[model samples]
Target: VLVCLILRLSGNVGAAPESALITSLPGFSGAFPSKHYSGYVTIDGKPSPKNLFYYFVSSERNPQLDPVVLWLNGGPGCSSFDGFVYEHGPFNFEVGNSTGTLPVLHLNPYSWSKVSSVIYLDSPAGVGFSYSENTSNYVNGDFQTASDTHTFLLKWFELFPEFVANPFYIAGESYAGIYVPTLASDVALGTKTGAKPIINFKGYMVGNGVSDPKFDGNALVPFAHGMALISDSMFEEAEAACNGNYHEPKDQKCSNILDEIDEALSGLNIYDILEPCFYGSAAKDDERKNTSSLPLSFKQLGATDKPFPVRKRIFGRAWPFHAPVRDGIVPSWPELVKRSGLSVPCMDNTLATIWLNNEAVRKAIHASPEAGEWTLCIDIAYTHDAGSMIKYHLNLTAQGYRALIF
Candidate 1:
């Protein structure tokens, strides 16, 4: 559910031993073999006023020998706990019969922490329990975030300085596509300039990410077209009307075509494109029943002129207006809906949200007194700086960093 870029370290590092240990975690039925640590590290910004919260999990196998991975969830504002709970963390929220109380946690078999020691960080000062005593720091940008996060790594090592010499990797998903490389660039450059607590920075691991805003936006139409989600006419109209630009279409028709694309995909769980959500992870029964209540276009909202396709039989049950038209046509009238009704398979960030907002959970994680609520993503007023990461990737490769995208 998260787009990630991994910075894989190639060699070993040497550091003095120290004790930064985890006593226990709530909800695990038994003892955990690995140590866990959660705390806040004050970053050097505004001459002083800031902190970034983190959850560090040591490998179950070999903590000393295993490389350290700094995993970041990209929302430019989202909490890394989303990654911790949903993606690759050591534990996850349990299934619920209802959304009435705090969700319990369960150990994960496929956690990345099973092999490598991982640090899940809430970054950019304003995310998760990370905060700034001076609110002005909340309005940040790519370099500013990287700069502070780099300082955070240095200071974090000061706390568990034993791992300072461990191979360090930076991985981020989504906007962290923006965040990861930017941070990697900072670490690489800082090391070159002889920055203190020298980090054994390594390479990148990511899926295709947003490198160039323009290309990222422009590529959507072609991708949708390739997927047969949009009509050729719609694609042609989008290309012609906006002059091959859809990021912020100036022409009205292009906007209409873009809206059509949205309408086509509205019924799908974008993260897991194969599934149509019968109910959102957090949606109650009444909410599930109200899936049909979402407003639609005049034609889709109103009655249609085309004759209904012949109903099909499944186990002798006649099913009419079934979902998922092969021609990429709109869903049946009953299937017409919006985001609230959607849920991704094997993903429930909503569950993470429910758990983190609990008072006890915050206390357990040593959450900041300043941060009011824990959320999957944060919407901060970050200044957009890098238009693309092409230059950054080229630079890293030139500096001898290997790159992998899955």
Candidate 2:
């Protein structure tokens, strides 16, 4: 979501870290309109370090004055680059003829960076290019993720203090529905508690976010019924069986009805119901084969848990979607995959997987060679400690922090 560019001249106090500056990108030959910087910010140093990676694109309109927005993509385990590559990032990628080739990049006319500088971050250790020397840090939840991201912001500001006074905003889609508001609350608290490099925290935005388990879980039936994806009789039966509480069905009959409804809607694209499902093709076999070492969420979301040629499955089964646990941890991605053994029948991440894994691309972006493979989503033993984000939203909004839900 690219908003209208707002100008606000502010004083810059420190020099931007030169080492983090991106001189060039591998696939795109055109000159960048504004400065770009990327590198790791050590969230926890030494003995067992936790390093978070970020790619910062300065606002083309005014790097010095435009708002700085931190963008996140939610899977509890997903990468923000999902936004950077496919959504509102500055570049639009053209998939190569073969999966092994680097994607061609062109300037995106509707890039959010046109209006504001955007930081595409990989948060929580073990996601995307972010990593931890000690594997134990990989098991984290909402609180630690928010806290680490806040720390990233503080250290990031220290490296590029010029933007410290700029009006700062947080934006994300999907599961970031949880990430944005919670992180906003933390940033607001940081400013009030006299945290260093006081950011001019402004507001936040969430797109198709998940806030409460009860509300989110119950939304599917009505939404499906309204969309005409399910039958009148089926909807009536589900309503009667579940007593309008889809999140927690009282009996096996309701659960069975719900399963029937899922079967009815299974053929449609969960992300975009209008789109036809993509049955696996020979060209995609290579991409599918590359999944063994990749994160389970990507495979599960793509619905590739079992062997190829599986039916297109809905995202409802994936994490962040399974968000209404209210308490306890969502099953790890591999566990979910093992149980379902289904593939995402429509979604294809071939380009992102290929382009990102390229040695040239990694080097160009300042990603460590040792960072291993890149994955859109990773497997994390995440505990839903934040429970319902309703309180966080109410708290932040009450404090005058603007919030947008789309």
Candidate 3:
């Protein structure tokens, strides 16, 4: 079969077929079966448009009739490329020699594209390649972000109307626990009100998400004890002191016990409890040398020494969003968790980051020349005004929408 990569459209700039379609990739050896499209969808149209960037990969087996799943990476500031490149995209970037060179791309055997079409979106105006000419749009809060995403989907369907009838499912990880449901609810409302470009709204899934802050807190200390990261006596003390309310312990001793729990699990990769933290591995040898249980310090991980050969931090105006110091039970306390869009302990994005930064790769994917360097996450200016999304979940179920929380 004939193959094409970047399809630079020349017709109506607003037309779907012309505007955001990608025809070529930077490092693929030959044209493969699956089709790829990458481009921007303007959420705010015309004068001062707010553009949301997206990467669309169709299923390998059947393009015309497959479930169209939308994937969003959490952090409220993290790029969906985390899902696209590392977790479930068509290719994985191969970081070579630890040199900041153009990383190579290799086909991913378990890419979700094998069964369903996927749209990986970088949202909220300031995240990833998506941006707003009006700086005021950057600091928008939770409901606003969800509203913008709903607008994105409606506009997107207008461009590719074929999948309007396909099984549509929205899925996200981490904080997207809030995003997915909020957006899904919007879609459900649109369906109910007979919105344009009719969407066949279905269920959604949230993996390792932050559903309820209170629920999230209830399990941490118990989970730590179960994992053998803490002693039984410590667990008993925490349970008795906190009276099962770890979020806001009733007494000072309970609060102290919770602090003790934090100390016990101090530097372990909070993302994956079992994995060795690569943070302290300053040099190539350092990464391999300190594989034991001891929590490696930032200095011992060679932080002050200009760092290890792999997993370099892409710090700048782009990609270094952080949780607030007073963040709720889930993100706060675990020191390095979600800082600057940092990947959980073992995720390696060196290849993806390098490849995406390459000039040719950027042009092939139709990246905006003006948008700054590609980073893991953006230092997004967002406010969490929604507090809890339990109401959104209840609302979805009330509207007959199915849901999955993992």
Compare candidates 1 and 3 on TM-score and give the better one: 3
Residue 82 of model 3, lDDT score: 78
Candidate 1 residues lying further than 4 Å off, grouped into runs, are: 1-20, 96-98, 248-250, 278-348
State the lDDT at 335 in candidate 2: 51
Worst lDDT 10-window in candidate 3: 1-10
Better of 1 and 2 by TM-score: 2
Model 3, residue 392: what's the lDDT?
88
Candidate 1 TM-score, true structure as reference: 0.78
Badly placed stretches (over 4 Å) of model 2 are 1-11, 45-47, 277-339
- Cα RMSD for candidate 2? 6.4
- In model 3, what is the error at residue 333, expressed in angstroms? 12
Q: Count backbone clashes in candidate 1.
A: 7
Provide the lDDT at 332 for model 3.
Answer: 22
Tens-place lDDT digits, model 2, residues 115-227 = 99999999778889998878788888788889989999999989988887778999997778888887898899998899987788999999888788888998888888998
Clashes of each: 7, 6, 9
| Full candidate order by lDDT, most accurate first | 2, 3, 1
Model 1, 1-406: lDDT tens per residue? 0111121252334332233345655555677768888888876667458878888998888887677999887656777886787678887566455544555667888899888889999988878878877877787888788888888888877677556666778886766778888889988988889887677777766643557776777777787788776688877877887787776678678777777776665444333333333322344564344333222221143332221110000001011111110111212122221323431122224466667777766777777668877765555666657657889989999989977755
Cα lDDT, model 2, residue 39:
92
